[model samples]
Target: MTVHDIRAALAADKATVGTWLQLPSPDVAELMARAGYDWVAVDMEHGSFGRTGLPDIFRAIECGGAAPFARLPVAAKTTVKAALEAGAQGLIFPMIETREQLNQAISWAVYPGHDDGRAPDEPLRENRGVGYCRANVFGKDFDAYMTRRAPELFLVAQIEHIRAVENLDAILSHPRLDAIMVGPYDLSGSMGLTAQFDHPDFKAAMERIHAACKRHKPLMGLHIVQPDPEELRRQIAAGSRFIAYGIDSVFLWRGAERPR
Candidate 1:
């Protein structure tokens, strides 16, 4: 599905489901993708996989007709460039608490003159290194991809701290921001309430963030890390569009039970 499909689902109060991948194996990636996820995000930050085999993993996912996404550990330009080079169609940037961080992360994804008017605040042009890579079929489609299609990649800022909740408006206002996913554990941890999703403070923060997303156009996302069917339904009813349901490791230990 396209971003428009996600928006349509959100407009209808439906959820667009995706999953997470932490293992490096293309076998694992293909399996999850074939399992019917709209997208599968490789947890680069926490996944045991290194950068060398990202393209293979992504290819496997694509073969199953799913978009391959990356959950970046940090917003480093090199990391952003690497993931894009490896054919990541989407990116979930972690621990973003300020507009500057989010802006820089977006900048790294877009090439020069293709900023799409997103970095007006930046004193410099986009620093993304244009190169022949798997994303462009290794220069086969480089010209067209670099000039226009590259900007079509999905970019998400992960809201994982109380500070991000507080600054939602500024962060969400970015024209280049495609989506925002809530890292509930990190968000609660920042509030001195690690993993305490039931805490009133955490609940309040979620409400604020959700409201902020509604006020803006970015698709609201949530990580249902533990794969609770009831919780997933509840969150979808409450308007989460980009939903990450199961981690690859969790599916391994718990067995692959398709979410309802």
Candidate 2:
């Protein structure tokens, strides 16, 4: 079955929003999908997810008509390959701090031999070897699958640390970098504000990251907690193109708050 490309859907202004699945449960993922999200993210970075849990969560996400994305604990080639083989359609790499990190993230996500040293957005010089399974399984018919899935899978990088902010330009300018996401809490802590998004330090960092995204013209995103619609609208007006509304657990917790 051809999976819906969540990243492509969003790029087309198709209202693609996702909630994280902190636990590996197909039932929960199915319910969440029915509730109206376009994608489901499996949070391996902060959850109990391991190699054992990957396939289960990914399958659940797939069963829900929602694309599955893995937020890796770190941007390691082996880790990325593992999740992709498990059937994740996208990857969100955390704490990306340099251009080299972006390149590595792309290298890990894409097939090998694909790096013809050409510009990122440009056409490939050579069809890279299928060094991964997501490619092998779905992209087995390379030409057809590449036409459908190559641009569909997202290779996202998080901008949350002070060093990342300082290196934002070089990082964003890298051809392989697809999107830039903000980790407000981590970014606040990195800026010494420690969860204080209202602080000038935190605000400045966000602005810097936002401006960098605008300059680079890649997708810009944020994972906000209980985000006010107006505030979200303001950011969109200000330049953010991608936004994750909330976490899976938080959405569940809020729904449970209704008086019975």
Candidate 3:
């Protein structure tokens, strides 16, 4: 399982760019992958794709040489397991507001015995191990997959709620958490200031998040919906290593409208 080098890039404080796939078409996914994004996330929360359709899209993205990631609808164990089994090299768990939630999300994303020397039949059996799936090439690649690929799986917590901002320190301190993705719209809405990116309180929230990221050293992620070069550069300058640049639908819409 060849994966993107996002983990090392983020660890070394280098910028990594990715795009969101909101459309359900594998062709669109492949196109985005081939455009040279470090990662391509399938938006299960807002996209038309569901569990049944995820694996194929993941395959398509991998075919184009980009790591496949999934933005889960919620931080649920079943959803995380399903996405991992479908070949998502990483996950973006939405609406995280507490340390416990982040911890649970990490637990679900990782195989228990892989980190700790616990038996599969231990007291927490069901919650610990992942069954043979596409992630392990359906058993053929189990050894290499566990030893090489699993360690690089990225686990991101989306900080969308005001409470998550307030609890940022504890959430960032989670040992297994790899990155923090900010959902500006949802964060603003949580603060009763929808779409007010320039509002003082919203700016303050972002400041706190950046400070926490600096303190904890996990990758700080921001979704630059417009994909302007200057804005991308600005975000990278501001310590955001995980940059998600726009969605598939919007990119297509804009490209279609451009004069030939």
Candidate 4:
């Protein structure tokens, strides 16, 4: 489906399940996309793929008919712009703690030219002049893409750090933020309860996130490291619209060990 379809689903509060692709191979990306994921995120932060490697993987994912997303290492302007230019229909920005940080990310993601006259705190309105990258079909479909597809580009703010959790309300208030994903491990570490998913502190943090997302407009998302169908269902029932279920490596390892 197109980015427009994904955006519509999120707007309708529909459950969209996706997988994490960290193997840095277009083949793996294509394989995962073909497996019927609603979306696939190219994990650049923790994965080995650099800026140069993203386009091929994105192409492969699109070829297999799944929307491609990029999980950025940093919320820098250059990183966000490059990823979008390379054909990421959506972006997962990690470690965003402040409203300013998220605002900047949205500005870089949506604005193609400098100073569209938006307020400093507001993201630019136009999605033109992104300069003929893979996203616009290498300039072949630039106008059509800007006017049609670019508006549907998804933007997700990752609530990982404790500070982000504390500032959840303000962060979620950003009108351009399309979704919010919680990083359980990082949040646990931030709370001084590293890897303790069952700890009260961790569970409470998750609860706070759920409440905040329900209070806001953006879709709630969770990254599940293991393929637990029951837990996935529970999260969705709890209002997690975007569910990122497991990484490529973990799935591969589990499949390999299943016969043993």
Candidate 5:
């Protein structure tokens, strides 16, 4: 499906399950995409691969008919532009702690004239660069891509710090923010409580973040990193709309460790 489909599903508040890709291999990408995921996100923030491998991995994921998404290491125009041009249907910006950063992210993902999530009366803040690339079929469909694809690209913000949690409501208020994914590990680290998911302070921070979702419009997402189906279901039942199952490495390790 396309970004439009993902947006519609989020609007409908439906559970859209996806898995993470950290390996640089296109074969793994294709296999995961064909394994019943609605989408598959390439983990640039922590993955070993770089920009050079993105296109083939995206193509591989697309071969299995799943939307290819990406998690950016940092929000930079050059990288963002390249990722979108390489056919990323969606993007997740990590370490976002302020509304300003989010607005800049919107600018990077969207073109120069469209107000994807801006107020009707507000001025357009289009900041995406235009050029012939894979997304527009090397400019053959540039006009159509600019008019449609550029404006409809999915953009997600990852709240992974105490400051982001404190600013949650304001962060979620952005119209251009398609969804918010909680980076639990980083979040706990920011709170001086790394990996202590059960600590009161950590739980409190999570509670505040989740609470903000009930008061906002963007879809809420969380990662079920351990490959536990029951835990994945529990989060969805508790109100996660955009859910990421497990990273490719974990899945591979678990399968290999399973008794024959």
Candidate 6:
């Protein structure tokens, strides 16, 4: 039960770039960990990985030294609880639109009985990371488990709506928010230009997000398909810290698209 310091690692210039593993199998997660990613998100928002398949993926991420984060379908309490209990070290809620939703998202992420306002160095939050029965009953020491698992389970929110952009200040100012990710597709749609990455409105939205993020200091992420190395470098230069490079199906479709 050892946890990887993903935030510190990211701060130390360790490229935490990872792909979205939409597949149900743990093998993909294991493979990505072996590839030395900082973390991998099990895409429950779009992937077919329901309750049963997600646990194995989370375990695989731990075994690989890559953090396990789940992109829940929404910022619902039950969904977040179930994912965390299943051993997901972090969460990413999709289609976020308001500050109220962000606060609600943190409410679901933290332990139910404990107060959420603890000093950073305190162990209140750490004590509440009671893992699932499988991990707990397996005779894994809880403290060791937490030392390895608790602190790293980041609560990330995806900001995609133009309304969210309008309320960016309030959203980013929430104390519990650990990171913010951009849903480029939904964002483009929000801008009235679906899937057009080159659209002026889309670029403007990205800039606004980047600019607003500077004020809050949470990890900022962008979603890209078939991302190039140079583009990754450029984003890092622009102050983006979290990144999702590709998804499970993209690997398959891109492989199929290879020029033979």
Clashing pairs in 5: none
Query: Each candidate's lDDT (Cα)?
Result: 0.86, 0.70, 0.84, 0.85, 0.86, 0.74
The residue-by-residue lDDT of candidate 4 on 1-260, one tens digit each, is: 76778877866778999999989999999999998898999998999988888899999999999999999989877888778889999899999998877776677777565332245656444343357788888889988878776777788999899999889998998877878989988989999998999999889888888899889888789899888999999998888998899999999999888573
- Total clashes in model 3, counting residue pairs 3 or more apart in sequence or in different chains: 0
lDDT of 5 by residue, 1-260 (tens): 66677777877878899999999999999999999888999998899867778899999999987899999888888778768989999999999998877887778887766775665555556588777899899989989988877777888899888999888888899977778999888999998999899999998887787789889888889887888889888898889998889999999998889697
Pairwise lDDT winner, candidates 4 and 6: 4
Mind sharing the TM-score for model 1? 0.92
Candidate 6 per-residue C-alpha lDDT over 24-114 given as tens digits, one digit per residue, 9 for 90 to 100:
8888788876666677888887788878776788888888887778889877877887787787777888877877677666766665454
CA RMSD of all predictions: 3.1, 4.1, 3.3, 2.7, 2.0, 4.1
Candidate 3 lDDT over residue span 1-260, tens digit each: 23446766665778889999999989999999999899899999998888888889999999988899999988887888889999999889999999777766777776656552233442332343667999899999998888888877887889999999889987887776778899999999999999999999999999999999989857789888877889999899988988899899889888889687
Clashes of each: 0, 1, 0, 0, 0, 3
Give the local distance difference test score of model 5: 0.86
TM-score of each: 0.92, 0.82, 0.92, 0.92, 0.94, 0.86
Ranking by lDDT: 5, 1, 4, 3, 6, 2
Ten-residue stretch with the least lDDT total in model 5: 117-126
Candidate 6: give the clashing pairs. 2-148, 3-148, 89-153
- The reply for model 1, stretches above 4 Å from the true place, is 1-14, 116-122, 256-260
- Residue pairs clashing in model 4 are none
Residue 224 error, candidate 5, Å: 1.3
Q: Pick the winner on lDDT between candidates 1 and 4.
A: 1
Query: CA shift at 27, candidate 6, in angstroms?
Result: 1.8
Instruction: lDDT for model 6, please.
Output: 0.74
Report the candidate with higher TM-score, 4 versus 5.
5
Residue 28, model 1: Cα distance from true site in angstroms: 0.6
